[model samples]
Target: MSSAYDMIPVLSCENIDKEYVTERTWNGKTKTIFKAVENISLYINEGETLGIVGESGSGKSTIGDILGNLKSQTRGKVFYRGQDVAEMDEESFRKYRKNVQFIFQDPKGSMNPYYSVLEIIGEPLKMLGITDDEEVIERKVLGIMDKVGLSKSVLNKRPDSLSGGQCQRVAIARALVVRPEIIICDEPVSALDVSVQAQILNLLKDLQEEMDIAYLFISHDIGVVNYISNRIVVMNKGHIVEMGRANVVFANPKDEYTRKLVECSFVN
Candidate 1:
């Protein structure tokens, strides 16, 4: 018999393609089509971290946004628990939204400056109809904040007043408040100091072990991905050029682009 981990994918993408149409004046006014993503397909198992790495403009973030339901793909299908997400009814989609959360690159900008830390973390709970009771919401928010290494003293403060790492903690706390099954982290630690990045990555690893949550971690840094990911997928100009176990890909990169990425990661 197989364990729950092997039963079904937490998230799946099939032949996903994304394109942007722009009007340009190259010769005269003409329409230009840019392929942000093309024929990309991957999946995340329960409690697994699938890391996507590439240089800037490689469509890593676009893939993250599509997976998180922040944007729609131009073609192909996204499935949650073997069910097509686009075909989900409103009620099912709402539940899917709660189960899939996002952690953005710019921690400070992702949050509202005017909202208190408590409010920022608790807002998702309220939006999901988890609870309307202020006391219960605060209790849950405080609990998650503690788990994310935040102090109660910062609860009443706005995100602007907190350090970069602290702001990211709040974001993590917010994502955890929903008890999400999958989180799409888009360069979640790139903006923070090197020391702080390690802390956040460690926290994510710990949480994954404890909660059995799956992560779609997107970043330009192969080293960071190698530290946290079980499997790694390398993207180039929207195409998946190389993918394999983190160690295997890092040790013996098969593609030229992947080799270059590995080289640059070590150099930097």
Candidate 2:
């Protein structure tokens, strides 16, 4: 087991930039350029949770998409285990895709209402070519279900039958089924109630400890970020203004926007 001081960075984003361009009708012809992420750089260490907090349109979710290799970066490089993600060929990227997974903010968005929990959780594994060993796959699936506090009894049920929290657990189990080294959680707990949020947060923290997985947790709630993050990165308009230990950044915010965010934080 590695201690806090022995943290190893697994993902590095250097001078990362992205923009969206579209053609519009302005005087019969026009063009628009919208910047989604601007020079955002941060490193996520192995077995550590790095929480990113920013309001809406602050490029929090875009960072998750970029790092998960779901979306390409227009400029700069995203290094996963010191290899440029942009440079990965289809064959090499297949392996990299296995090492990284994403947990979206909306539980329903991640799951399919028409599919049973088993299918939803097992589909990704199947797509990644987990076959010829049915018994082993069942064991792995059940093990992950147990890890997320999900019971086998609910495995046959459709997503609609489960509560929101249970649905989130199923989503989490789905992500864990792939045995990814890192999980990019795009505000996984924000949509749940406070009590349920704590349960999920504890579940994630425990899982990170047990599985040796790193997390890039994105959220707007500083309180939630502080409750779960090892490090905090404050973003504003696609730029990271502050990055440091969670406690240190919360206790002493250097950026005025961060201070305003702290002022708006839940004091209760």
Q: Best by lDDT, which number?
A: 1
Pairs of residues at least 3 apart in sequence or in different chains that clash in candidate 1: none
Per-candidate RMSD vs. true structure? 2.3, 2.3
Q: For candidate 2, what is the lDDT?
A: 0.87
Q: How many residue pairs clash in each candidate?
A: 0, 0
Candidate 2: stretches off by over 4 Å: 1-8, 25-30
Q: Where does model 1 exceed 4 Å of error?
A: 1-6, 24-30
> Which candidate tops TM-score?
1
Ten residues in sequence with the least summed lDDT for candidate 2: 21-30
Per-residue lDDT of 1-268 in model 2, one digit per residue for the tens?
Answer: 6774666468878888988876677675548878988998889988888999999999989998998878888898899877888788887688788888888888987787899888888888888885637677777888899999998999789988898899899989988999898999998998999899999999998998899999999999999888888999999998999999999998999999999999987654
